[model samples]
Structures are given as structure tokens and as C-alpha cells.
Target chain A: MEVDKGKGEAEETRKVAEADRDTVTLKSSDGKLFEVSKEAAARLSTVLAGMIAGGSIDDNGTDLKQIGSEALENVVDYCNKHANSIPSAALISSSISFNTAPFKEPEEWERKFVDRLSHDALFDLVEAANFLGMERLLDVTCHKISEMMKGKSPDQIREVFNIKNDYTKEELEEIRQELAWAFYDD
Target chain B: MGRHSRRASPLDVDDLLAEILLCLPTLPTSLPCASLVCARWRRLVTDPIFLRRFRACHWEPVGVFHTIFQSGREHLSFSFISDPPPGSILHDRFSVPARCQDAGGGDDVYTWNVRGCRHGRVLLINMPCYDRKVHQFLVWNPLACE
Candidate 1:
């Protein structure tokens, strides 16, 4: 009985060690698995943090059914990159002046990270980041999209985003007249 | 994992769309131009909550409003002095409404003094020419042109 008790305690210790791992395995909707630093995942994502805190994380792979494999890969890549990058002085100072700063500009590496993505991949990553509650990643992705929107005509914007122009000619004319100054080339 | 087909665009979600739109450039033409994209975008950009959020996000002064008074003229003319990265705001985009200009009618000349400006609004005090007494107060929103 004592030998059995000792073995039981050893098994319990092994389970606890597994649960206390430094990294977590996540399963994307397509059933692919990715590993991320537990600390980084918890820090970067509110949903992951909640799952971690609530002890709901599965050892095999905590399922993220809303995220596709490609987008989840990008999320993992961003978290890993964020972990390695040092926060710049501007970032630190901006954090201190939180009330005055609306959004912190993305670091250079971050800008490059999202810049290389194809349009579909970028939008997919945005949805994934938003689903994971990753605020910084969402900001970076959204900033890239907004930059694409700047300086484009409405027709160009519609073309780029695959949006259908629903206004009749008369309705469009009325809006143009109402906000004529906005359309001035100068 | 099996490769799946592409998902729907995130912009289909209104909340996500707002997040993207919230980051647009802070120029005066940004929202107005965006409103012409589609009916959905038009509705989103004109929403009071979205406008409030946009104001909060881009709090820097876009331009200045100054009154130009010509001597012996009955009315005060306001001009927008644009501060720019090229085309921020047009000089004539904002104007004092005709109602305010017509307030002092038929020889009862009133001097208009700008009391304050805050949150895209201007407060004016209309004082009768014959006396120092405050005759009336007028609140104006040049953006709405009302």
C-alpha cells in the first residue's frame, strides 16, 4: 500500500509539471497545432489569459476554433516577435502618457511583419487577432488597412475592398452636393 | 490540419469595421470621403458614437476660426484658417450661418463677440450697439452649417 501511494504521488507530480509548462499548444480550427510561449500568450491575449487563469487550457491543444491555421500561425509569429523585441523609449514614454496618446505607432519590425502579407492573409489575421483579444496586433493590422484607405477615391476604395457601390446616381449626386468641399482636388 | 477555403472578410462585421475606420487619417476629408464608399460605410461614419470616438482619437486642432470684420459692415464674417499637411481644410468650408448674420436687423446693429470655442462649436455673445447689455447668446456649429 505504501509503494502504491508513493507511485501515485509521483504521477501527481508529473501531471503538475506538465500543467506548469512554460509553453502552450494551441489547435487551430483546421486541426493544426502550434506552440507559443505561455507567458507571451497570456500577456498578449485576453482570451488566452482567461483560459490560462481559469485552468481551462488543454494540454494536448487548447482549441481556437474561430481561427484558421494560417491566421493562427501569424498570431503565434507576432507573439514570438513581440517577446523578442525590446520596447522602444517612445513606446515606454507613450505608455506613461496614456491619456494623451490615442494609439502607439507600430514598431518597425511590426510594420514589416504586416506589410508582407497578402491582402486576404492580412484580413484573416485581423479577424484572428480580434478573436484572440490581441489589442496590439489588431492595432497594427487595422493601421495597415487604414493606410491603404487614405488618399483613395471612393470608387478606388470600393474596388480595393470588394465593396459594392449601392447608391443610385441621384443619391450620389445629392451627397456630392452636400459635401462638395470634400471632393475638391486642392 | 486540412487547408480550408478563405473566410469571409472581417469588414463584414460592424465592430471590426469600426476598428478599421477608427484608424483612418485625421484630415477633414477623411470621414466625408469615406461616407461615400457605400451606404453601410456612410451610416457608420455618420454615427454619433463613431464621430465622438473619432474626435477623441484625433484631438489635435485641425484648423482655426477667426472673425474678419470690415469697418462699417453690419455683420461679422468668420473664416477657417487651415493648418496643414497640404489639404487639411478649405478656407471657405466653414461659414457663419445667414440666420446669425440677419439677427441684428433694421438699424439695431449688434456687435458679435466670440465667447469661446470648444468641441467643434463656437459660442457668441450678441450685444446691442446702443448699450453694453447682453442682448442674446448664439451657439454655432460651422461643420453642420446650422
Candidate 2:
């Protein structure tokens, strides 16, 4: 089954003039529903895209429910905004000097963007990225994951991942001794 | 409770834990602790996955690994192998270093050699095509590429 191009072009054109667009219906696993952006529902979610493309999507201005609703919404919003926004040439040149958008010296808008999320939300986004197969999302998640790894010993990581230690005390000690140097930094 | 309802679940938390541990990346250091969690976990320690890729490095075991087969051994060949079949008669047999005298500095003697060292981290290889000689060797610690 083939979907019409881009969730109806006239609808998108009308919404560009007006903001706070009408909701796209999303169905949840337990037969729940949620209302979200048509732009977002169209662009970011491959699952949603497949539904539309396959002509399986009902989408009649109803609540769009999702199994992982918040996670789905966050991902859609991120993708939609990122897709539409143009990069600042001034920021581009300035960023090149340092090769990074300095997190410490971030713009007010950037700070507010992250401030809205909870730890659980952050984790759910990572899972969402993995589910969506988004590389940019994966990099963000991996960097977030590695950042968590920093300053943490092996035991801490295992615990964080809900991993249980299978080594005996003596064996653990022996292994620790073998990798004693790894504990120290360069 | 009735007799049928009185029985406990067949699978416990530990059983689930064992499956999780077995699914982890095989790191030699983590195996010992992971196996000790329980008998099921202990059984997973012997799984080839835990034994195979887990030994990423740290096999630089200091010892005399070779016999001095020749006084003027210039070059050799090496094969870094992880596991050889246990209790096989051919384990280290047919795998002897055959060495003979080669000219010092500016000489022509060609032979190839091969060896296994330290859970298979490094291979020390020496081959001379002109003089037709091959030498095999393995290093306890393989150095980083320059």
C-alpha cells in the first residue's frame, strides 16, 4: 500500500500560516489515544509513516495514543523542529573554532530545552532513538551513557545496567589486580 | 491453599539473573563474578562465548616461551591461537621451533617459524624469501601500532 505524499500538502501549507495545529490521532497498545502534531507525526516516526503509507492510519482529529506516548512525542517534536530550523551562520563559524556547541555557554533557548526533561524522560528518549534507528539520537544517547560511565567504577556500571556480579570474591580480586592500571587515568 | 496452588514458581529471580549475565559482552574479568552468582550462572562461565572474545588483551605472561633451537636465529614465523583442543597429542607437538645457524648482519639464510603465545595476543613472525627460511614466534605482549 502506498501513502499520499507528506500528510496532505494543502494541510501542511495551511498550518505553516497558523501555529498550534490540530492533533494527529495516535493509537496506543491498550486502545488508548493521544493528540499530537501532524507535522511531527508525519516526519519523525517510521511506524507512523508506515501506517500512513500503508493506508492503515485513521487519523481523524482524534487523540493520538501511543504505547510509550511521552517518548514518542518527545522524539517527534525534536525531529520536526530540527527538520524545519535553519542553522545560524554566525553560530556555525564560532562553533567551528571550538568544534562544539559549548554546553556551559549554551544559549538561553538551549538551556530551557533540556530543562524541561526528567531523568526518566532522558532515558526514554534514548530508548526511543534506538527504537527509531536514529543515529544522531544514538550518538546523543551514547554520549549520555558514557557521561554516566565517567567517574564510575565497574561495579557502578553493572549496578546501573541492573547487572549482577558473578565472580567469587577471590576471582574478583584477582581480576581487579590484573586490571589495576586501568583504574588509573592517563 | 490447595496442594496445586501451594507449589512455588519453577523459575526464580536467580534463573533470570543467570540469563542476563550470559547475554553480556564476554569480558574475562567479569566472568568470574558473573559465574559465581549461582549454579546456572556457573555453567555459563564455561560457554565458549564467555571464553572466546572476552580475553581481549592482558596476556603478557612473562616466561621463557621458546627453546633456543639455534645460536644465530635471525627471523621466525608465529601464529597467535586462542584455543587448541585439550588432551590432544598434537597439542604442542609438530609445533617445535627448528632453528639452524644463519650468517650475521649481511647473510642469506631463509626459513619460516610459527608460535602461539599468551591467549593469542601477539604473533612473532620471521620469513626470508630469498634464502628460503621461515621463523615463527609469539609475543606475550603485543605492542600498539606506531
Candidate 3:
């Protein structure tokens, strides 16, 4: 009976320790593990906040089966970087205004963070950010992609995005005629 | 968590595509130019819901429309002045009809006077040269060319 009582005390201690933990372990689709600050994860990602609040976080490694290892690594890196960086005054004010605020341009650090990624990596990170419900990350990544599209013609956009131009010559010409101003520079 | 099948490509998903497109520049030419990419993009951009969201996202005015009158010309021509100065393609597309059909099934020349412009729409009062009392109100949307 004494040994069982001691075992119960140890189990309670373990639970208490986990409750006090400042970081959470996440498992990628490929079974890789990543550690991120609990505060950062909860603050940045709505899904993570819900998971943490609902006590659904797994102490071993919360499985994120939708995210591959590379993308998950980028996500972790971004969270760590975001946690360390002090948000600017503009960001704080925008956060206060929330949805009504105009789209805020990504900061210089964020620009450099995404600019170093390969095209595939950037797309993968965007998917991961979206799946995890990381709004800021998704906004920064999407902004990077939209920047790639600006000032380019339809053919140039198609070439950049690798999309097929399904419109036949006649249909394309008709659309061009209808919105002639948009295509004048082309 | 329940297992879910992965999409073939991230850009293939409509939600993700909309998110990316939502971040496009606020310029008036952005959507029209993006719609030219493919039928799928055309469908997405032209969707009324997407258009509403686009307008909500970009609430700033991109250009202005004003009347240009020549020294001796009887008709007032409309001109669009792009705020950021887009290319020289703003001429013929923004022109309004100089003549409106009268009750007698004949085209009547009217002098158009600009009353107000708001929400991408231009309001004008058309007064026929023969009658000083006939005031016809015409609201023209240059973006829709209607």
C-alpha cells in the first residue's frame, strides 16, 4: 500500500511538471519532432491555442500529420524568430484594430525569412502555415507570393506560377478587347 | 485527429488560392490582369463574393474620372486620370454616350453635367439642347463600363 501511494504521488508530480512546461513538442508527418515555445504557439496559432486550452496537447509530441518535416521545421523556426523579435509600434496598433485594419506589409526580418526559401519550400511553408491556422505566417508567405506576381503580364504570371493558359486565341482576344486598358502595356 | 488526404498541390485548393489572391496589389488592373491567367482564375476573380471581398480588402480609390471639354466641341468627353498614373490606355474605355434615345425614337444630343462621383460610379445630369427643363439623370460606372 505504501509503494502504491508513492507511485500515485510520482504520477501527480509528472502531471504537474508537464502543466508547468514552457514548451511543447510537435511531431511532423514524417515522425520528426520539433520543440516550440508554448507561449508563442498559443499566441500565433488559433489551432494550437485551442489544443493547448483543451488539454489535447500530447506531451510526447503533438502529431501534425498534415505537415511534413521540412515545412514543420520552417514553422518552428518562424515561431522562434517571431517570439524573439519585438513587434513594432505599427504592428501593435494594427493588432488593436484587428480585421478592420488594412493589410500590413511584412517587416524586413519577415521578408528576409521568406526570401531565403526555395520556391517549393515557400509553397510548402504556406500550406503548413494555413493548415496550422497561423495567420501572421500565412499573411507573410502569401505576401511574398503576391509580390512575385505583381507587374507581370498574364503570360509572365502563368510562366512564374506554372499554370496552363487554357483559353483559346479567340476567347483570349475577346477578353483582352473587353478589358483593353488592363492589357495595353502587354 | 482523423486522417486526411493531401491535395496534389497547395495552389490547387480554392481556399488557399483565394488567400493568395487576396494579397494582390490594390491597383484596379490587378484582378482584370489576374483573370487573364486561366479560366479557373477568371471564375475565382469574377465571383461576386470574391469581388466583394476584394473591394473590402482594397477600399482605396485607384483613379478618378472627370469631364474634358474642347473649346468648340458641343459634347463633353470623359477622361480617367489614374491616381498612380497607369499607362496611356485610359482613353476610349471610359467614354460615356454623347447621345441618349428620346421619346420620339431618335437620338438627341444632350449636354452632360457632372453632378457627383462616388463608389466607382459617376452621376451626371443630361439636358437636351432644345429643352431647358428636361433633366435626365444618368449614373455611369466606368469600371463596369456601363
For all predicted structures, in order, the TM-scores are 0.82, 0.42, 0.81
Q: Chain A vs. true chain A, TM-score per candidate?
A: 0.88, 0.53, 0.90
Candidate 3 local accuracy as lDDT?
0.78
lDDT of 2 by residue, B1-146 (tens): 01112122111233333333433422222444343344455565556665453343223332234334334643232222333223211212223233433555455444435444445354555566465554544353421110
Better of 1 and 2 by lDDT: 1
Cα error of candidate 3 at position A28, Å: 1.1
Q: lDDT of all the models against the reference?
A: 0.79, 0.44, 0.78
In the range B1-146, model 1's lDDT, one tens digit per residue, is 11223457877899999989999977667888899999999999989999888888777676565555344343445444443235544555555422233444456455667789877888888776677698888888766555
For model 2, the superposed segments whose C-alpha errors exceed 4 Å read A1-44, A61-69, A85-116, A131-135, A158-166, A174-186, B1-124, B128-132, B137-146
Off by over 4 Å in 1: A86-102, B1-7, B67-89, B95-110, B128-130
Q: What's model 3's lDDT at A137? A: 91
Candidate 3 has an fnat equal to 0.61
**Order by TM-score, highest first:** 1, 3, 2
State in Å the error of residue A10, model 3. Answer: 2.0
lDDT of 3 by residue, A1-186 (tens): 999999999999999999999999999999999999997787778788789989999999999999999999999999899878856553344322442446678999999999999877888999999988888898899988888888777888887777889999999989888877554646
Worst 10 residues of 2 chain B by lDDT: B1-10
